[model samples]
Structure formats: C-alpha cells, structure tokens
Target: MDPRKQRSRDRLYAAALELAAEHPIADLTVTQLAGAAGVHRSTFYEHADSPQALVEAALTAELDVLREELLKDRADAATAVAKVTEAVLRHILIHVDLYRRELADGAGGLHAMLSRHFRGTTETLLERGRIDLDVTVEGMPPARVADAAARFLADGTVGIIDGWLRHPSARVEDFLRVYAALLPSWWPHSPAA
Candidate 1:
C-alpha cells in the first residue's frame, strides 16, 4: 500500500471511530466523514463507499489480526482462545458507545457483519480441526453438524454481545463470565473451566 493511501485510510478510520462514537454511522453522511477525516470526498470514495463501510473495514481489520494470531499460536490452544476472546470483548468495550449506537436495533449492519465474520472464522477453525465439538446430533453428517454448530456459536455469541451492549450497566467481566459459561464443554480456553 502506498504511504499516502495508508495515511488517508488511517485518518478516515480515526475520524470514523470518533464520529461514530457520537452518532450512528447510518445517520452520518459521507461529506461529514470526509470533512472529519480531512480528506477530499474523492479520497474517501477511493477507500469506502459509505461511512458504515469504512467503520466496518477498520473494526474488522483488528479482528482479522486476532484471528491470524489465534491460528499461529500452537503452544496453548485454550489460553490462546481465551486471550483472543478477551481481546475481542475489550475491543468492543473500548468503543462501547459506538457499538451501543450501531447495535441499538439488534439487527443493524454491524451486528450482521459481526455475525458473518464470526461464523466464517468458526467454520475455518472447525474445518481445520482446530476446535473439537463434544456433542453430535443424531443422523447428521459431520459437515452438516459443523455448519450448524458454527452458525449457532457465531449467532449466539453476537446476539449475547449485542444484548450486553444495549444494557448500560453491563460489565465486561460479567459478560465474559456468561459467555464462558455458555460455551460448549469441549470448547477450549473456556474461562469457566
């Protein structure tokens, strides 16, 4: 990536996070983002089509890094999983206001994107046999079971996070405890274990 382009993207991402913390990205205009980012509208267009797109790209980039690290860390699967999950939760907590606004409706774009990203990540881990499932449904093929499990974990986790964000008094530690308790017994790195 060109240094100039990278700088522009960084500016855009910073501006998006700042602005999104105050207002829902859906209600923000591209012009507002361009002005906040100190980039021309054309420059903004070069990166993302909408403010929501830019915010999603910026947020998911962090998650992608965590996912890559999780795949590379082989010394302790359980610890690695716990660390990554905590990192993810902390990341959201850091931007709690932004997430609260974005996910206020429960079925917002951010929620859907997160669900898709998590579902894909879980599917990858399962396909690689990085995670084990201790329970099996009757008469279901392994692949079918894996898909169902992935969707369940992804959607359930996202839904829980969304609910937590919607509640103003919910603490991160409390959410983590609940999340860990809800994980399947075979899941590695469960804080509850």
Candidate 2:
C-alpha cells in the first residue's frame, strides 16, 4: 500500500466512523463522505464502492483484530475466549448509536455483513479444530454439519445483539448473560458465567 493511499484510507475510515455516528450509513452520500474525509470522490471510489461499503470495511477491520487474537494459540482457551468476547462487546458498546441506527430497520446490509463476518470466523475456527460441535444430526455429512453450525451461531448471535441494541433497558451485563446462556456447554467460555 502506498503511503499516500494508506493515509487517504485512514482519513476515509475516520470520517466514516464519525459521520456514521451521526447518521445512518444508508443515508450517507459518497460526496458527503469524500468531503468529510478531505479526499476527492475519485479517491473514495478507489477505496470503496459506496459509503456503506466504506463503513463496513472500516468497522470490520476493527473486529478482525479481535478475531486474530481469538485464533492465537493460547494456553487457556476459556480465558482467551472470554477476553476476546468482552473486547468485542466493548467495541460494539462504544459504537452503540451507529449500530442502533443501522440495525433499526431490521436485517439490513450491516447486519448481513456482520453475519457473514461471524460465519467466516466460525468456519475458520472449526477448520483449525479450535472449537467442536457438541451435537450432530443423524446422516449429516461433516462438511454440511460444519456449515450449518457456522450459520446457526452467526445468525443467532447477531440476532441477539440486534435485539439487545434495540431494547431500551438493555445493559451490557444483561446482554452478556443472555449470550453466555445461549452458547453450547461445550463452548470454550461464557463471559457472564
């Protein structure tokens, strides 16, 4: 990555985060984002196809760091899982308003992107034998089972987070409790347990 290009991307990401905190990503225009980023519209296009795409890229990059930490070879899987999960929850809490606005209309682009990200991360962990499925359906192939498990975990977790974000009285601890209760007993850790 060229230094100039990297700087431009950083500017765009920072601006996107700031603007997203104020308005829904779907309502944001490329021209507004480029102006906020202090970059030309052409430069914005060089980085992302749309304002939503830019915001998704910027947010997911932050989540990817925690995913990497969760994937590392730690001695205590439970502790590592708890730490990473808490970190991720804290990250979401920090941007709660942006998430609330994006998810207000139900399963939209941000929700789908989050589901895909979670599903991909789960699949990678499964492939590396970092996690195990506690239940298996009769006559189901291992590959299909893995895929189903990934989708289930991804969709269910995202759904729970979506509901939590929408609820007026929802607290981080309450969300964590529900999240921990919903996980399989075989899961490495429970943040609220």
Candidate 3:
C-alpha cells in the first residue's frame, strides 16, 4: 500500500491501457509494458510475472473506479437485474477498448479472471440475500449453489460484454433486452439449462 508502489502500478496500468489501444492482451508483453511506462523490466516483473498478470492488474485498477463511481447502487432482488444491466452497460461503454483487448480474445483474454471474480461477487450477494438460489456443483452436494450461481452470472456477464464490445456504440436498452430474454434459460432451474 505504499504510495510509491501505487504510483508505479498506476504508471504501468496507464502504459498497458495505452498499448492495448494499439495491440492486444495476447500480443502485449511485460518488456513492452515496462518500456512503455519507462520502468525497468525487473520492476514490471516485480509486480507481475506475465503479461496476463499485468493486464489483470490494469483491468482491476480500471474496474475499481467504475465500480465506485458507476455501480454504487444496490437494488432489491426483483430490480437487481436492472441495476446490473445498467452497471454492465456502463462498464462496457466506458472500457470497451480494455474489454476488447482482454475479453474479446476468447479463452486467453482477461474474461477468465474477471468472470471468476464476478461469479464470486454474485455468490457473496446470494449468500446475503433472500432469493432462492440454486447453485450446485457438478457432482457434489448442495453447498455449492452460491458458487455455481456465481459462475453462471459471471460467464453470462462476460458474454454480454463481449457482444457489446463488438458494437460499442449500441444502446444499453438493446443489450438489456437481449440479455433479459436469453438469460433465464441458462439459470439454475430454468428447464435443464
């Protein structure tokens, strides 16, 4: 939490974002990132072992700002989907370049890491809520419902964001409509997925 470390990370994140504008997550490397930030290669390695890690850190940095400023609202269970839709649309709109660089690359992108966190976040919410969640493991007992729901929500969000990233200027309503119509069948008890 040192201010110096924060500054270094900020510089690296900025550099990564800039380079992602031209290149992509898979194409960008730690050496290029360090050089872009004017930091030594060792410094970049001190923070992250690979370009994926660096990109993850950069994405986490950007998401913090978005979560605080844009996704601060918490709604009731019935309306939570709306809040999520708004927040996700804003996230995609605000960071489409980063999304494209990280998530649009299929499995090797940032979506894997970010979607795991998203699933975990949803699990926390379900644990603290009154909703009848149906999260379940592949072959385990019923204690894993929250984690399972988290994965569904996380991957669903990623897919939506991936589509939106391909069409950055589309209306939020359009995405929300498409998602609302398609997501229920993929939920826990939605007719065998």
Candidate 4:
C-alpha cells in the first residue's frame, strides 16, 4: 500500500460514492467513476474490479469508523453493547441518504455488508470478553453460547434498526431505551441459570 496508491484508491472510493448518491449503482460506469476520482480508468482497475466492489469498500470504510468508535470506550458488557448500538444507529442516521439507496436496492449488497460487519464486530466484542453472557444453555459451551447470542443479536438488532431507518418515526433516544431494556439486567428473570 503505497501512500500515493492509497490516496488514489480513496479518491476512487469517494468518486464512486458521490456518483452512487446521484445515480443508481446499476447505471454508474467505470469511466464516470474514474473521471470523478480524477484518476484514469486503469487506476480504478488497480483498486476495484467492479462498481459493486467499490460500493462495498466505501460502505466498509464507513462501518469501520463506527467499529473503531465503539472500541474506544472501556465498559461492562451491558454498557459496551449499549454504546455499540447507539454508535451504529447514529452513524446510520448521519449517512441516511447513502444508506437509503443502498438498503433499498443495490441487489442486497448493502444488507450483506452490514450483516457481515455487524456480526464480526459482535464476535470481536465477545472474543475480548467485553460482553459477558452469564446464562448457559444446555449442551452449549460458553463460547458457543456467546457466538450464537452475538449472531442472534446482530441479526435482530440490524433488522430492527433497518426497519426504523425505513419508517424513522421514533427518536434515537427512545429506540435506545428500548434496546437497552433488552439487556440481561433489564430482563424480569435472571438471564443466567
């Protein structure tokens, strides 16, 4: 990763995102992306093979920021989860326009990237022991339990947030309150058995 090459790649990604915001990904062309990026078409080829790859790279760049932000604060499992959820929603709201198009169409590219990123982040949290899963399910090891919990949470939370993004009626704080209540401590019965 040479510095100049990295800058060119960044420019290509930025150009693709800008074009994507104005036109559908299906309609965008490599020449247009390269032109906007101020790079030659050959340069773009060095970075990404296709427009979809550019879209995924751009989206991953954005999501990576959210992940880094979540990793900043040290807290208990419940608190960390809450912070991660809040950060995720805030990031989405900030880029609602880009996400609206991606989430709406784009051949499920956005959904796939989001699911993978969110789930991987959740798995990282579990691996770091930042989020403790006290409850043990029968026949499942603690680590396996954590993995399953992370998967479920990642899927359910993303689904819920995606729905909210589509409708966007509730305040962020209101949604967060509901999300926090899903934590083990907020549950009526002890989560651990």
Highest lDDT, which number?
2
- Order of candidate numbers by TM-score, starting with the best: 2, 1, 4, 3
Please give the lDDT score at residue 136 for candidate 1: 81
TM-score leader:
2
Residue pairs that clash (backbone atoms under 3 angstroms), model 2: none
Query: Residue by residue across 69-176, what tens digits does model 1's lDDT show?
Result: 878877466777787888788888888898888887887888887888788878877777878776788899888988888888888988889888877886878888
How much lDDT does candidate 1 score?
0.84
Q: Give the per-residue lDDT of model 3 (tens digit) for 62-156.
A: 55554443234454444554555476567666666767656766676577877865675566556566245644567776656556666777898
What lDDT score goes with residue 171 in model 1? 87
All models, RMSD in angstroms: 2.0, 2.0, 5.0, 4.2
Off by over 4 Å in 2: 190-193
Tens digit of per-residue lDDT, candidate 2, span 1-193: 9999999999999999999999888889999999999999999999999999999999998899988988884646667777777787788888888988887776678788889888888888778777777768889988998898889888888888898998876687888889888976666664334
Q: What number of clashing residue pairs does each candidate have, in the order they appear?
A: 0, 0, 1, 0
lDDT score, candidate 3, position 109: 56
| Per-prediction TM-score | 0.90, 0.93, 0.77, 0.80
Quality of model 3 by C-alpha lDDT: 0.68
